[model samples]
Target: MPEENYDFMMPNVNFFGPGVVKKVGERAKMLNMKKVLIVTDTFLRDLDNGPVKQAESSLLKADIAYVIFSGVEPNPKIRNVKEGKKAYIDNHCDSIITIGGGSAHDCGKGIGIVLSNGDDLPALAGIETLENPLPPLMAINTTAGTASEITRHTVITNEKTHLKFVVVSWRNVPLVSFNDPLLMLDIPTALTAATGMDALTHCVESYVSVNRNPITDAQAIQGIKLISKYLRRAVANGHDVEARTNMAYASILAGMAFNNADLGYVHAMAHQLGGQYDAPHGVCCAVLMPTVEKWNIISNPERFSDIAELLGENIAGLSVMEAADKSVEAMIRISEDVGIPTNIKSLGALPEDFDKMAENALKDGNAFSNPRIGNKEDIINLYQQAYKA
Candidate 1:
């Protein structure tokens, strides 16, 4: 076999700890950003004493002008991107500061893409479609999932087609990313569980991806171990500083893994459900993860076995195939422990729509790196299995 070359990408700089969001203004100033657009969801924008407010205070202290664009919706849509771009243009903002989770970060990236390139969001769906450099973007993460803050990929939904497409480019990576655990201390229990599971899915899919290399494998393994140890703690007590800090690190580690090595069918299929149902992205990924991985275990049993152990499964004395099966069981167990929905059907996904969703999943950028090259039928079967699981 020949050696394969791979590329690893992440934000140029990352800050992690408590209250590190205070650096946002100073960082923007250092970047020579005159006026900035703050992209976030309405809830965060209005939350008292929230990270958004902390960021605003920082920007004010640095004498930077900013306009808030709080139209970011869950599973960020094309219209959200368009609205954010308009806000940036209207406010004459020179940079972007995305506050919140993946939706806000993804919407900011989309807005930057259109501002630098063209307005055809759908036309920019494939990998590296970006020809021009994006504006200076800073991501302040308030949640411990998605890792969109550090990743070079953004998932955006096209309202017209009702499909979520990924745009992958090193240019999409933020200039800086902040992962302050304090911001995550107030996240709801359900959200914490969903995001933790999402991070775990990233680790698993990237570890088994055909594109996986030593670097990504190490990150994915570490992320899986951390999520297994701390996710439940964080969900049980949102204010658990230790759990929140570790989960934040886990999220970024998984981001670094998948942002480079890429992801598999779990993310590919989950994106379809998000686009169609406007369902929570993390929850969709959590529900579909085990089913997809069950199908993928045949592609790389050793990797699945590794995941089984990393997820704290007792795989000792088991055959390779048996240990790999443990990985699937562990995933299901974690989802159940975290109170995630038992099946996609509970999340409002319709079996009748599985055909189109599977078709779209095949075309997702993440699908190319999937360990198993599943056909449309294979994807539909996995969806059905998850529907009943």
Candidate 2:
């Protein structure tokens, strides 16, 4: 095989497996970070109930000073970022450690980036706007999706505009990320299923993205295979340590792929549903995955065929196009098997709002990376297909 020229990006350190949560404080100490600001949500700050307590206890045992700013919410808003920034400054924190899922990581990134750059949150809305280096930051991921912990992108909603803005920069990437399956033992089955599917969607979209290269293809395919083999098991039995471990590894692999290759319409469309309806990001991705892939198969039949084979679809003598369609069918089957709703209507999205959601999807940053460039009408049609399932 010829050497491929590709820019593969990832966090400096990715710690995984059971009992790895203990390493958070060690990594922070190595970075010379003493006083840390822990960014998360109220639900994640309850010492007895939150996963963050695990890290907090580890930090305390390590004799590292810290303060908690647990105000982050789902589809995290700029207001949350502002409040977190104040907390970071008020506590005289030298570093940041985010504990939870993407929401917590994103809020931490937002606060850290703004504080280090001394720039207003609104000014850093677009891609690579923060020119200066950010403060030392670490992320501990509890979900199997989003991959925000390891990525340079952070999606923060501008409440006034009712639109989600993605802030991207190499500087915003965390210094380290911890993925401990032991910490994921308690996530509900529904959340496990939804987040697992979101990881699958990331692999599928990145594998077929316009920016995909050989390096990304390897990670994406491995991620797809792992999700196919383990997502159901993890969802069925959250306490299955092996299943959770495979899922955590799968999420990290998928994150590395999309972090560089980027995503496609599934994420483009799902972001709108999440912002507008406050729907679970993974559920929205699960609902839209099959429909968007169906639309995309014609544009890149070979890529979809590869996906079909990876998912264990029987494509024996079928043509590429037929095999591609089989991949879409496989996605839908897996979604149903994991208990995802069959249609957007189940999420309370009305037909009347389809136009607005479609418009937003069309304008999403991830849409530009899709193999098939879709206009407003195409997006609207896709929404209709998804709405009816």
Candidate 3:
């Protein structure tokens, strides 16, 4: 076995709590940003009361002006970043304040990187490819999943190519990360569940990734434990602050883990679905989790067995292999309880597209970390299984 070690990347500053959303302006001032590009989706920006409202109040209090670019879509695209960058340049914005989930943060990251380096977004598509520092960016996460607010990795969907390219660079990690559970209280139950499952996927995938380390293992295990305990409760009742808070913390933990340990095939395939049909990223992850892990368990039965126990599977009389099988079973139960759609056919992805999707998935940066090294045939099989699941 190859020795596992990693150099972790983290946000410059982190703030967590119910009212931390009101502190964005203070942090913006600390970063000496005069004007900011406020990147968010139309839904958030249009909310009468939410993170966007709270952020605006804070920015006004701190005397920091901003330009709102509210065109970011559900599965954010390269065009969204380009438009945001245009808004930033035209409005003379000095920095960025990203609000919402991964879509908003990923769009802001692309804009910030392009703004600073003067390079095309496609040019910075790979690991550490950025040559210049990105403009200061602070991310306020309204959802308890994605963790795009803190991670050094950004996923930008190319409109023309239909590929969600992974951009890894420490320079693009948020200068400040804020997670306020109160912002998540109003989210619909389905969304809460989907996002929670996404966080769970991060922990599970990173725990068995090729880059897993002692530090990542500690975080991933704890994150799995937290998600297993609270995900159902949170989905059952969005008003449960305690469940929301725990999931938020778990998201951060998983983000910390995967930021260094990286992800696996689940994300690679999920990204392809997201890029192809603009499907909800978390829902895709939730639907694919069990199918991918069943095949993946053979790579590291011990780790998968641990995941089974962490997810509340009883393993008193089972072998590690049997317990590992329990992990996939547990994921399926949770998916049903949380209302993660069993089939992804709604996304218009068909069996015929599996081969092409698999070809693209094999090239994803996340695939390199998968415990099981697979070819296009293996990926196609996973896709077929997930589609019918």
Candidate 4:
């Protein structure tokens, strides 16, 4: 067996808890940043009821100059990054602050990478392709999912090919992350459930990924437990601060796990679904996760057994394989309880596109880290199961 090297990387600074948004100005000042590009989405910029304004108020109160670029969309595309780059340069922004979910943070990272390296967007597609350091980035997470704030990976879609590319590097990890549960209090139940399940997928896939290590396993297992225990409470009542806080912690732990251990076929496949169908990334993962795990259990039943236990299933009397099967069942029950539809069809995915999505997923960076090596046939089967669900 090749000895595993356990090297874990996390953001240097994390300010978590309620009202952490107020600290952004002080933190930016400490970084010596005079002007910041506040990267967000249109929903957040509406300012009628958004976290961006709260962040903006903090910056303004501190006498910091900033520009708001709120054009990012779900499943952020290369175009979003390009436009954000233009905004950054035009505003002469010295730093980047992302206030939203994964899309906004990813757009910020993309802009920072392009700004620092002067590399054409297409050139920086693969893992570790970035050669230069990116500008300092502060990510203020409004959602309890995606955890893009602390991750070194960014997913950006190519509009022409409809392919989602993953970029990984230590340089891409945000300099600081502010995770305030207060920002998530008003999120609708459906969005809450979808994003919470996304966090669960991260923990499950990272725990069983081929790249798993001791550190990641520990974090992933703990994250899974937290999500299982609290996801429903948060989904049932979005105003439950304790549930929200637990979900927030789970998001960070899951991010820490997957950030280093990497993800599996669920993410690899869902990226394609998101890019091609313009679907919610979390919904795609929620729909595909069970099918992919069922296929993966054959490769490592013991790991799945661990997942079962983490999900609060009684597996003591069962064999590892049976316990692993129980884990899949538990995932299905939780997903359904949270109102996630059982299949890709529920999300309007066409069956005819399965072949193309499978092919793209096979070529995804996350596919390389799955516990089981799947061919196109296996991928198709997983898609079919998800489609039929």
In terms of lDDT, which candidate is stronger, 1 or 2?
Answer: 1
Model 1: lDDT of residue 320: 98
Q: Name the candidate, 2 or 3, with the larger lDDT value.
A: 3
Model 3 / residue 209 / CA error / Å: 0.7
Candidate 4 lDDT for residue 183: 92
Alpha-carbon TM-score of each model against the true structure: 0.98, 0.95, 0.97, 0.97
Task: Identify the leading candidate in terms of lDDT.
Answer: 1
Using alpha carbons, what is the TM-score of model 1? 0.98
For each candidate, how many residue pairs have backbone atoms clashing (under 3 Å)? 0, 0, 1, 0
Which stretches of candidate 4 lie above 4 Å from their native place? Answer: 1-3
Q: Please, what are the lDDT tens digits per residue for candidate 1 over residues 1-389?
A: 11287667888889989989999988999999999999999899999999999999999999999999999998888999988988898888899999999999999999999999899988888898999999999999999989999999888998888889988999999999999999999999999999998999999988988888889889999999999999999999999999999999999999999898889889999999999998999999999998899999898899899999998999989999999999999999999999999899999999999999999999999898898888999999999999998
List the pairs of residues colliding in candidate 2. none
Please name the candidate that would achieve the greatest TM-score relative to the true structure: 1
The RMSD of every model to the true structure, in order and in angstroms, is 1.1, 2.1, 1.3, 1.4
Error of 3 at 277 (Å): 1.6
| Candidate 2 lowest-lDDT run of ten | 1-10
149-227: candidate 3 lDDT, tens digit per residue: 9998889988897778888889989989999999999889878988999999999999999888889899999999999
Q: What is the descending TM-score order?
A: 1, 3, 4, 2
- Residue 382 CA displacement from its true place in model 1, Å: 1.0
Off by over 4 Å in 1: 1-3
